[model samples]
Target: MVSTTTTSTTSSQTTRERVLACMRDFTSYQATRVALYKEFEEL
Candidate 1:
């Protein structure tokens, strides 16, 4: 029972980490795209 609980907790943490990483990556991509668009407009 304890092992199962530990495994569940670990999986949850891993999932959370993956979600946070994806969010960070998406945000960075948006920022880069915005910057590129602004530059294009300036040009």
Candidate 2:
């Protein structure tokens, strides 16, 4: 029972990490896009 609980906890942690990573990537992408747009506007 303890092992099962540990396994579930690990899975949940990994899932949360994956979600954070995806959000970070999405935010970085949006920032880059906005930066490019600003540069284009300046041009």
Per candidate, the number of residue pairs that clash is 0, 0
Worst 10 residues of 1 by lDDT: 1-10
The sequence of per-residue lDDT tens digits that candidate 1 reaches over residues 4-33 is 546778888888999999999999999999
Alpha-carbon error at 26 in model 1, in Å? 0.5
Report the Cα lDDT for residue 28, model 1: 100
Write candidate 2's Cα lDDT for 1-43 as tens digits. 2445467788888889999999999999999999999999999
Of candidate 2, the 10-residue stretch with the lowest lDDT total is 1-10
TM-score of 2: 0.78
lDDT of 2: 0.90
lDDT of each: 0.90, 0.90
